[model samples]
Target: MGYSEEKLIEEKVFKDPVHRYVHVRDRVIWDLIGTKEFQRLRRIKQLGTTYLTFHGAEHSRFNHSLGVYEITRRIVDNAFASRPEWNEGERLLSLCAALLHDLGHGPFSHSFEKVFDLDHEDFTREIILGDTEVNQVLSRVAQDFPKKVAEVIEKTYENKLVISLISSQIDADRMDYLQRDAYFTGVSYGHFDMERILRVMRPREDQVVIKQSGMHAVEDYIMSRYQMYWQVYFHPVTRSAEVILTKILHRAKHLHEQNYTFKHKPHHFYSIFEDRMTLEDYLKLDEAVFLYYFQIWEEEEDEILSDLCRRFNNRNLFKYVEFDPAKEYKKLAKLSMLFEQAGLDPEYYLVVDSSSDLPYDFYRPGEEEERLPIHLLKKNGEIRELSRESDIVDAISGKRRTDHKLYFPSDFLEKEKARPEIEQIAQILELNLDNGTI
Candidate 1:
């Protein structure tokens, strides 16, 4: 039998918290899961730096990846199998795309990506198409199979139905992560009637639509996503930790550029620091590797680098206050100067971060990062965009909300407040009255 068609003598079942059981029967899937590249996900956390905030949020990407695969499998084999719109030939391709979509996420995910200008999606394509174990295993099915898998994950596959199953507004990836993250973190915000939504899904030529009967369940799902973003994902404490983490990366790179010698050489980070990190170099990185360097850098000679590393390791995160970027520009400038006078480097110690979200948006052409809107299928077989049919959805649709915060080392500012030289700046910030939290 061909590798793609080969089934295991017995189905392999993974007992999962979110999906209950991830059943694997195809030899191709079983082999791909055993590949070293996929195994590396076990060492990478699903929610980076979130464990510090939600202590139970220690689940790894390997767990979330398998949940995503299982959700896609259910949609393909259970919901859409007999539907005329779903091509049976695309089943394996969809499963592969769902499982490998997050294959290239680095340690600390977004924070690391921001500092180094790395795109995990770019690395994801490289891993599937380059000379790697994942590619080798995929090549066994067919010479072009690996490219097909990569294209599906990249949202460039010709099969629009397959792309929509993974990338659309309410797809398998988000479905898995929302419930999975909520389960691990013990939060109720990500909960919704997923089973009902899955049952009512109808496949279309270009996208997936929900049966009219399932509108309320879909509404619940949307609200769950909106709440999860503000309550759990964008928790202020989590952002503070991320701010410290980003500074550590920035300080290390700056030191590297200045020819600063390290007491403990950063062998794993040298390629990344040079911006020439190869596939091999990237594959060698995981959270454990980063923690090792951070542990040793605590004693490094560079005060900024060592201080930032110490703060991250010890959980001494910076405190923040509400900031308005448009109106508070002068206040921010004054704070930066005061931070410097108080023996804190404004670049490393004073920072501003913003978080924003669009609860739901309808299709808008010619806009950057255009997203496919959700559609609901009527009883007469006609389809309507979700917002048009549901009053609840229309209320918040197309609205964007944003928040900004100014972060600084309140401990240093408190000490400097009593000093005559920097007292004026400290009072301007009201550190003495509020103890630095707002």
Candidate 2:
């Protein structure tokens, strides 16, 4: 058998809580799973700092990657099999793309990316084309096979159908993460009829379309996404942990720039701090390495660094109140000045975090971050955008919802409540420090 056609002696099955069982048989996929770079996902989290709010959300990207591959397998092997629209030759390519889509996520994924100005998508492409175990496994199939997979992940592949299987708004990546994250977080909001959505999926010349019969299921999925964003993804407690984590990274980077000596030197972060991080330096980082530093940094000499690390390590997160930047810029300025007068570092202590989401959208080419909207195929073979066909989808189709919160160490302010500055800060925040109304 050719490299692409090879199959394992027996199927390898991983027991999964969300999908029941994720089976692997293709030789290329089996080998890719064994590669060290893929195994590294077991140590990285799927939802960074979310576990601080939802303790059960400790699952890793390994679990999610396998789930995505399994969903794609069901779609190709069951739904699209022998269909003239879906080329059988693209089966393995779709599977490979689905499996490796999130291959480059780092520890504390989003927060780390923000502080370092790093993009996981770029790192993912590098891992596939660079001199690495994943590259070697993919090269066995074809010299350009690694590049093909990278392009699919990059959404630049010529085959739009293959790209839709992973990159589309309703693709395998979102399907798997929504269900898997809901299961691990023990929340009811992420629950949707994924089985029905998978069954109704049809391959189009340029994108995936759903049968109109499955429009209700698709609506449920969209609403689930909306609820999850507010209930879990943007939970204030989770955002609090994220704020502290971001400050920790910023403090470390600043200290590195200041030539501050450390008892527990950040050897793993040196390359990143200097803005010269290589692939090897990146692959060496995981939650374990970061948590180790956080535990030890609690003892560092710098008060800000030590306090922040202590809070993260000990779950003493910051408290937050609703803040609207557009309507209350003056209020925010007053709070910042009062915080400074009370000896609190406004840069780290006073933080305004905003989260926004557009539940669904129709395709608009000129808009920023253009998304190919979900299309539904009617019984008469007419195709229409989902929002136009379904009232529930239309209600929130193009509307963008944004929320902002101002985070601070309320305990710090409470200790000095007798001071005039602290009193003014508490009044502005609508926080009664005397009675602990925060």
Q: Could you estimate the TM-score for every candidate?
A: 0.95, 0.97
Worst 10 residues of 1 by lDDT: 357-366
Backbone N/Cα/C clashes per model = 0, 0
lDDT (10s digit) by residue, model 1, range 1-438: 788899999999999998889999988889889999999999999989888899999999999999989999999999998889889999999999999999999888888988998889998999999998899989998999999999999999998889988888889988988899899999988898989999999999998999999999998888777787877788888888888999999989999999999999999999999988999999999999999999999999999988888888999888888778898888877777767777889998888888842122332211353567888999999988787888877665656677888787777666556766367765665555334453
Off by over 4 Å in 1: 356-369, 433-438
Worst 10 residues of 2 by lDDT: 357-366
Question: What is candidate 2's lDDT per residue for 168-231, written digit by digit as tens?
Answer: 8798988898898899999988889999998999988988999999999999988887788778
> Candidate 2, which segments miss by more than 4 Å at Cα?
356-369
- Among these predicted structures, which one has the highest TM-score? 2
TM-score of 1: 0.95
